[model samples]
Target: MRQHQNRSLKERLSNSAFCHFEQRGELPCIVVQHPGFTASLLPQGAQLLSFCPSGDTSWIWLSPTAEYQQGTSLRGGIPVCWPWFGNADKNSPEVQAAMAEGQPLPAHGFARTNRWTLTRLYEAADRVEIDMSLPQSHHIQSVWQGDAELTARWILTPTSMEMQLITTNTGQSTLAFSQALHTYLPTTDINATRIGGLSGHPYIDTMTGWQRKQQQGDVVFQGETDRIYLQQASPLRLVTPQRTLLIHSRGSRSTVVWNPWITKAQRLSQFEDNAWQTMLCIETANAADDWVNLAAGANHCLSLRLTVE
Candidate 1:
């Protein structure tokens, strides 16, 4: 790590022993190597595409069919779902209100597709930090009300990885929206994975009439599963046959657990139907009744941390 800090940016890029930074064709990316972990980041949307601890393979399950093209949401990795959580047509009252009048709004807002500026990227003795910001411009003020900026930062330490999203409402009036770090995690098998810590919350099951139900035990995926657990922000554990993944978060109001089984999995672009068995999402979010009411000049932040046993 001392070597990383001593090297200049050019030297660091050229020296693979410290770090790797390159503009791959048009997609710029950076990979940091600390004694405890290795992590990668993409400038597009300020996304964290990969992370692996000293003795592990990749814990993030990136899609084999992911497209690295600009302006397109890559199939996997942690997607920054801000200003909204789903389709604008679906209409969470606050999300619909922020959209440009009469224009077809994109899925999960504009933060993910926009190219974010790297605010800071540095290596220290114990870890590496990469911070980025998506500062919205006035040219799109006609599209969305309020002046706001979104930032995502990654902290790669020896034992765990932390990612945070900070939103600042720079304009007057209040801003209302739901957001999430839509994170896709690796799984040995969907059937063998059990999610703990969501056992007692009231959740809306997306597969069956959007009905609300209480979770009785650790969540297990049998068929298709999409549920929004309201108001529960406890640390969660993903128990699989091979290992257990622990997730802890702060400033997050809701948790969404989703797995597209047979039918829905078949319809998704850049995703293989049978591939669903290898990955599942336990998203730390502010969705449903948990929408944020950010006042003028105020700020809000949501963060997630991951560890494994």
Candidate 2:
């Protein structure tokens, strides 16, 4: 007979709040908490970071850091930046020229640095809802002609996690941009883990001069892996010997999977020496080569769901 032990109330609460939660369909969810943010996860351990009154718990770090750097101020939670992805070099003359024309900011655009307002919070029978919005900033206006709005919603249950991002162009002309949900995941060993789901797809390796290649098998961790997967019709999967994480998306034209190990992690003060072995970045996005074109007075939406078994 298989022995079954029920979890203690404290354990359940801790898991539900900090680690896991039980919902319908025998699904379990994880919870991530910090001072200001409280988010739930699916049994598969996929977390949705919800911005709340107290603080945010989402991880934030530079390229070389393995662990997320803790923010000193309330304004510094894991920010979701848009319009541009990756570095905005301060020393680059080309970047400076763009700034001179009003497109100024550091790498990965201004969305992550800007503050977002929590618009709604409620609970349904089996799920919790969270909503946040980012409006056009002066910096954004200087670079782009019209106003823009980004609205994000998180709906969660113990068995599932869903995120929706809606971008609206309030300006006069069309808005061309790239966007992504930069998710940082914790693991036991990144090098030992193999990401499934794109077994036979093609990807562009940004680290290797943007070379395109067909994936023969599951994605394995080796050194520094930076790839933007184009035309990916398969779901993204992260499988360890002990756990498996599945990421599903709709309306996203691209996916980005990255890891900076060893020497890269050594350069960042925020990361511990072995931290890179425990984290991964698998983002569902429309970025880089695949930019979005939003017409004036129009809106575009992207959605992602995470599940673990």
Q: Please tell me which predicted candidate would have the highest lDDT against the true structure.
A: 1
Show model 2 residue runs off by greater than 4 Å: 1-79, 88-103, 143-146
In model 1, which regions exceed 4 Å deviation? 1-17, 23-26, 138-142
Measured against the true structure, the TM-scores of the candidates, in listed sequence, are 0.91, 0.72
Among all windows of ten consecutive residues in candidate 1, which has the lowest summed lDDT? 1-10
Q: What would the TM-score be for candidate 1 when compared with the true structure?
A: 0.91
Superposing all C-alpha atoms, what RMSD in Å does each candidate have to the true structure? 4.4, 11.3
- The clash count of every prediction, one per candidate, is 0, 13
For model 2, residues 1-309, the per-residue Cα lDDT tens digits are 001211432253452323344442333333445333456433211224332323322222222321221211111112354665665441223223323253445556665544444455555555666666766656566754446778877766555667787889877877776667777665667878887777677888878887898888888887888888877554677786546767888878778887778888776555667778877777777765566777899998878776665
Best by TM-score: 1
Score each candidate by Cα lDDT. 0.81, 0.59
